[model samples]
Target: MTSGLDARIRLSRGPVELEVALTAEAGEIIGILGPNGGGKTTTILALAGVLPLEDGHVAVAGGEWEHAGARRLAPEQRSVGLMLADPLLFPHLTALDNVAYGPRSRGSHRTTARERARTELASVGLTEHLGSRPRQLSSGQAARVALARALATDPDLLLLDEPLAALDPETRARTRSDLAARLAPYEGVTVLVTHDPLDALTLADRLVFIEDGRVTQVGTPTEVLREPRTPYVATVVGLNLYAAQSDSSGTLTLVGGARLVTADSTAGSVWATVSPHSVVLHRERPEGSARNAWPMRVSDVTLQGQSARVSLTGPLDLIAEVTLASVASLTVHVGTDLWASVKATEVFTYPR
Candidate 1:
């Protein structure tokens, strides 16, 4: 069976101590999503062996790579490929030579490596540009060549640190699609560190949420998008979640005293997360089995493609996603008063 990459990195610089654990199965793209200073980059550095560990360990392909308790392996000995935001291509080498450099470094003859490099470059649709130097290629082409070079080593693990961040929006989108297709055939673990939700949603099978130098949640893209943990993650995933407390009998109450019955049976402090898309706006209270309703005035509204994102300020400053058709039907302009209904089950509850 194909193996995976497992890592647990803990370190301290001055008073700040960060510890994070990550695992990516074969052919899986695990996204590490977090804000700046959340220790996302630090974790990647530790995995790559650039940063020393204060504690914990790293294992890739079932082989130990680093640990505070064991002998640390050299970065070159680990079968891992890292692609940063910048391509960092050699100015003197052509795209073909750049892709072949990895295999050549590992003792493959120059001729054999170049032949293999041609195949890898072709996979990224860069075969035609093989003879082009870094300055001669477009930004997207350079990015593709860099990716091909990283893959030429046939590493057991791949690390992508915001690989498309350097490209312009148009180029970024096209390159992102190409990168996704190129990664489909690779039978190794991939760890993608990116902040863009669209990138995470498109490239990752599951997302491991990190914040305050710790992991807050880990789940599939849809799962994490549907159910966010902290208010930070809720805001990141564009959902609204509140700290809720409930009794033993399934009677749920919001922290601010809004009463609602939850389908979930739980006790003590818990979390109630609701997606703005699930919030239905009503001119008056609509008839439904939904158990929660709030009267809110529109604070702001922005058109988002075929849908409109409405910001409501009332008991909670929440954003609701509604279709453009509903916008004309409801006439939901600023200062408009409408009822917002959310189902009990739709308001997912989880332990705090």
Candidate 2:
């Protein structure tokens, strides 16, 4: 693929240090996913030339921005557009002038900049609100205006740091759709840093997971969802995960000494994942051929949409999801003793 963005950077600020490498093709949207302080925003700032790298390089659209500990361009010198969680629009400017600011700063004449802003605003469905001030617009409207302002610059790269985070649930959903539509036709590399799974899954072509200042996984949304390599990703994807050592004899010993028999086996450290739906809870020893069963005590129970997620602690900590009907029929509750079982085939094991 033709390179749109290529970067390998390392930065240190007192106690925190970040190192990351990333690449994207033109027209690709790469979602940056990570826990708090995992360097997601640091990566974005480095790419935008706002944060200087202690080492490494950054190249965008085949042009060098930073190389070998030297910055070739400032944040404004690079052809980049950035939008943060807060719109940060000039409160004194009308929507039209705010959108026009980028082009105007880039040397466009007054009339030309205003025309470009009008077209961009129209593209984001903000044509009717061009005269509206930031205070006069709703959360969703302001977000669209922010997007239009970003695109009006005709940037070669776009950086979005949790762009929809400030909106309410309903407004976020609507604005997300609007943002996706606007990004569809832009032939530029886009890096979106987001904590919301829905936004990343729906809008990004690929997902890059970072943790502890390092990249842990990179794949399509479907690929990451099907097999998460880290505990954080597994939790985000709603799966119970365990780190264990496996033996050739098909016995897997978890970190805490819990043993589970699996259908597949190999030596060395491995990660085991089990879907919450696959767990079976019983009041007593079940009369079945399941290979893995343990007496567990319910620690917590919470309703998630239509199902209840039951947290259990015993030989192995686990999460189980059951329908409300099952909850009522089994009389499940906190402090209840139950046996949890999983078929050997249900436990998926992969090398760490």
Candidate 3:
């Protein structure tokens, strides 16, 4: 018997037709990431039984929860827990009662449910705030409480949709750590829907990237990090990616007629990538052993912490990230003409 999640989610809304397959072993966290309106949330909703499937099926732990035109389980009937961006706690209820509500709704005895809530709250490090109401708790504390509530029923599957999206950066980081800790011991399968690459890379055992209502990629974090198939995924992983035709001698010919030299000797169609940090800028033509150097005009410059991302426009538009010190020394800004150089070794190529 199948003892894990196996789903083929298909649904059409307006112009978008979402058909994506999702599978995971028990205790695995599958991260779903994509752009807005890319069917990431729609897939989550379908898994939770909030949206009926137009076709395909949702099966978990050897049981079929949904089968298009055959059978379907209502949201309340499924052993699934859903957490969202908002905590949505009742104002009058204390944290304990809020967590207890889940088991109570499922028909557990009031005393038994409260005891279970206590255990769940303690597991999430919210034991000290059991008596606190929602308004009395900090955002991070409230988020923990929401997580506790979601897991209170001991669900077979958990659905988290942007669970940490509402927190401030500092709070988000801390809460993300807490979430990782809490989920580590959970035996249930978790399907996390997030737009944050960090969340997917850190929390998920596998990642599924849905774009324009179809899954564009699925792999382990390390696999996806090294080679992204689509432009949208390249942006998510922070790489300058290109579709190129390569010769056995390692010459890459881009569609625009521009070329780059790579250390890889892979021939035929391939995807090439260069990290922004691998790009170096010079005010004059760089004189070195670099195989890829071109005169490019800076189209934009955006400061991010100690570094700046310089957008260069030329034969192949590229973004180069450099230290602020280098930026000041080069006097880099929009409209500045500079030579960009990337070593042949920095270009990574993989089968398309």
Best by TM-score: 3
Residue 46's lDDT in candidate 1: 82
Tens digits of per-residue lDDT for model 3, 31-54 = 999998899888988999989999
Estimate every model's Cα lDDT from 0 to 1.
0.86, 0.91, 0.94
Candidate 3: residue 94 lDDT (0-100)? 98
**TM-score: model 2 vs. ground truth:** 0.93
- Model 3: how far residue 348 lies from native, Å: 1.0
True lDDT of residue 11, candidate 1: 91
Which pairs, if any, clash in model 3? none
How do all the candidates rank in terms of lDDT, highest first?
A: 3, 2, 1
Winner by lDDT: 3
Candidate 1 lDDT (Cα, 0 to 1): 0.86
Report lDDT (Cα) of residue 160, candidate 3: 97
RMSD of 1: 3.3
Q: Which scores higher on TM-score, 1 or 3?
A: 3
For every model shown, what is its TM-score relative to the native structure? 0.85, 0.93, 0.98
Q: Candidate 2: minimum summed lDDT over ten consecutive residues — where?
A: 9-18
